[model samples]
Target: MDYQLDKSCVYVQDPGPYSEGILDCENIKVEQNTYFAEVSGDEKYLAVYDAYFRLLRDTNPNLSLVKTNESIHDTISIYSAGFDYTGTSKVTTKRAIQYGKEEQANVTLYCSRQEGRIKIYVNIPLEMRFADLGYRYNGSRISTAYVGGSVKAGLYKCSDGTFQTTDGRLSTSLNAAQVIRDGKTYTASAAYEREGTNDILRVKGFYRNEMFLFCTPADFLAQGDIFRMYELESQSEYLMHNGGDRGSQEDSLTAFRYSEPGVFGACHDGSYIVPVRGPLNRFEALTVRVMYYVPGKEAVYYIYAKYVAAPHEIEALCAIDISDTTTAEEKANTITLQTGQTARLEAPPSDSWQAFSKWEVRSGSDLVKLSSNSGTAVTVTALKAGTAQIQAETSYPYTYEDPLTHAERRNWTTDYKTYTLRITSAESGGSSAAPKKGTTLKKGSISYKVTKAKSAVEFAKAPGTAASVSVPDTVKINGITYKVTSIAANALKGNRKVTKVTIGKNVTSIGKNAFNGCKELSKVTLGTGVKKIAASAFQMCPKLKNITVKSTKLTSVGKNAFKGIHTAAKIKVPAKKLKAYKKLLKGKGQGKKVKIVK
Candidate 1:
């Protein structure tokens, strides 16, 4: 009997009394070389290897061997190779020495095609972890190509230290098509053809995104592959275990499995692949954990790989969002900022799971830099007419529970949010900071009248459905910044949409009935410069439950300043001035019925 084998297909021939030579369906000639030199020692391992490579060649016939090499380590040898350059398609291969090892021998392979397609092969217990990948690309385009391995991965947005589901999870069996996100349709993946019709895989549509792909043997897709995809928008992170317990089921919220780091590599007996698309500058670090188990001979191994992008393809981004109004989604909106003017940038509010830990200016010329940056807010000065990007890094603690085993796990993950700033020239017709005849601040459905008083500007009234208002420290008019000194009587009276207010630091007084009858008002933060609270300033604010005063300059609190306010309303003042504030409040017959805290 005789045998013939090649990269695409394998054939067996009978000599003399047994068989005849055979040609493959693809019309490719076969040679007498073992499919994979690493696992050819044992019939069992060879059979597995042959089957795997056959599937790969069949799935995409463009793959061809490029080169192969070996590395000797004391008692063990590591064999490595790469597929022949076929236009844009390239594959990287790795196999551990299996001569005397009783454990399941395996090979790991990674491949990339020009069209943004990634494929990988992982055999046995080897696993790879990508600590950090992808760079920031927003409001601009950056094209990159990678050759080596294929993988099916999900594109996620970094949110508050956890990865949120931007695009749904992807699978190995999926074809290039559109993916759905947040009820919106988006381009998931596309195929690119090179000059000579070479196919490359690329993620075509979407704004700022990073992908995670796991390469596995074709059989794993049908044999309950350990690689799992999850929609973790509501979760900070997930926990998974590799104990061979396939039927395990548990409430992700109640219990969590053992999770090592960011994400676990697909562990099996084949090739594992990862193809990264989107903004990626350098491979800060790639860690692989190889867990070998052979009954009485269990062992563990690790491998690290570092790769960087070509200088021309590298970019540093400042992740920032800008808005002209005040709302929950303020930081996510895009606004036209006036040249030579300044805009305030803020991170999302804190919650039980995550918070914006800090802000940084990743990259920008003099046209964009941090005027003042802190975790809560930053003041950005638009030096000229151009676009600037800022990044808000958040910290979040990941908690998971495995219901089946009632296992609990905790981890920390850092998240990055990209904010886009479009700086238009002050001469531009759409400048957001250009002085207007009537400087009205519109938020949501309602609009507030910002009128010029004798010495400064004041909020006159709430006329629309706007729900939140942020009084700026100064209003620019003809290039002059005018301080906002007061909230005129009836400023926001009877406005159902008004909910929260951030008084400007330049404010000095709240006239009588200033915010009276604002039934929906619940939270207010008074600036430190406030010197007096006129009579009935906040009277009839039935829903005003909290007042945070950052001022120590309070001179007087007019009678009934907060009378008829919500009974549960709590007054919070600076610790050092708490006693003085309380005394002033009581002396003016304004307190004795409210809660005060330092």
Candidate 2:
């Protein structure tokens, strides 16, 4: 019944059976599900809705229709959908869960109003499935529908297609229960998903930035204060539920809002679920995105408070400036601030630290901050006095002494993965910007490099750990990378107390768990246009010890390949594969401790 209408906007062309991807089901609880897509005869037909499920046959080779003038607002279906070529596809977006392959997905929803901030972009096209749902269910710990846990529960799949049982029949014939949950109608945080498929991280069309905190209703909610909901997932950190928060994702098209002091909401639509306190029960179900707590405006800066000036000499530059504002409109962003006399020690003693290089402003508020143990160029001085657009972040002073012996147990350190870039004050004029850098940080300008394997992760603006920068041009101290060439694969795979890894000399290949969980990695090196080493790639590198395979183009070495190694750390093979590295070091028992070296 392909129909089309422009004025009131009504266009439909076969919108069902689309979602052939996504399933982190974050442990699954099996309540409601929605990767999205579908609409037929439900009666309310004014028209103008489109969403399909299943994509990737080379996606968009002129499939066209990636339009984004946006204006749909919300829709949910995915009670279940699957085709599995191996599986993987959840991470619906807010940026985190990523692993693809289940197939078909068209999720088309839109809303517009650029420049002021509501610029949402969700175009699902998948690939890359690491799959690791397993956690346990039925037996309990909850996470069914399937994640490997209790071998996947309830067996989702609905929307009337069929599948959802306590008696059982659909738990993982790929799972069903496509979308159907009210359990009585959960709002803010009912704390569902003892395991899998409860609300596949639901929330259809929402926005948020709410703020308020007498603390505990799971600690209020701070930041620009926004929380809208159709879906939100996070089992615990504090707690999170979904379905209604009414402040949708933001950038303001239908409405815009943000209250101060105790903070409130209304950035646009609705949907929020923030909370992740104390590993929640050992990462309970895991699905967090609440970035920065808005208690007062999150102004923490104390990376060693001042102990950062030892050998601290700053001077690194890169600039570009413009004003009178308006070319196509939307060109104003520069950060670097410092200027004051504020002190709080217990962690800033390299005599407080000092360094410089870079600042180009005019977005307004003249991006201020010039001192307090060397203002260290922050947020490009809230720009407004015109003339900014500078770039001089070649500053240096990287000291380390937290060898991560359990990393204080767990205040923070999954070997690190924090990234924030909320620099406000956008060259003033018609945008009025300024007052960000803490909406949970992360917006642009990030380039990293770390060779002899890798390390260029970002987001450590105010400390609490998360900084391993240096590699844009490559000079990775000890573990090598003097000239550099490759090592992207998760570069450094979480430096869990990095244990010796060096691989430079015009490198060639190492990506994919480039080092995966270091756990005091045990020395690694494989120069010479390397080749293939993927899969668990080095698994959790438990005291890796030694493995200098110098690939002249090696071939194959994946799968628990070197589980919990450390046969005195020395297995450098390459003498023409030395009988396939002496039968893979006697099937990893360590064949005569393999060693060919030259």
TM-score: which candidate is best? Answer: 1
Which digits, one per residue and each the tens of the lDDT, describe model 2 over residues 317-395? 0011111112111111222221221111111123223433333222232433323322333432222223223232324
Backbone clash count for every predicted candidate, in the order shown = 58, 173
Off by over 4 Å in 2: 1-489, 493-512, 516-598
- Compared with the true structure, all predictions reach lDDT values of 0.42, 0.29
Q: Which stretches of candidate 1 lie over 4 Å from their true place?
A: 1-455, 477-479, 587-593
**Compared to the true structure, candidate 1 yields what TM-score?**
0.26
| Candidate 2: count of backbone clashes, pairs at least 3 residues apart or interchain | 173
Worst 10 residues of 1 by lDDT: 15-24
Candidate 1, 316-359: lDDT as tens digits:
10111111213212222343355666655556545644554678
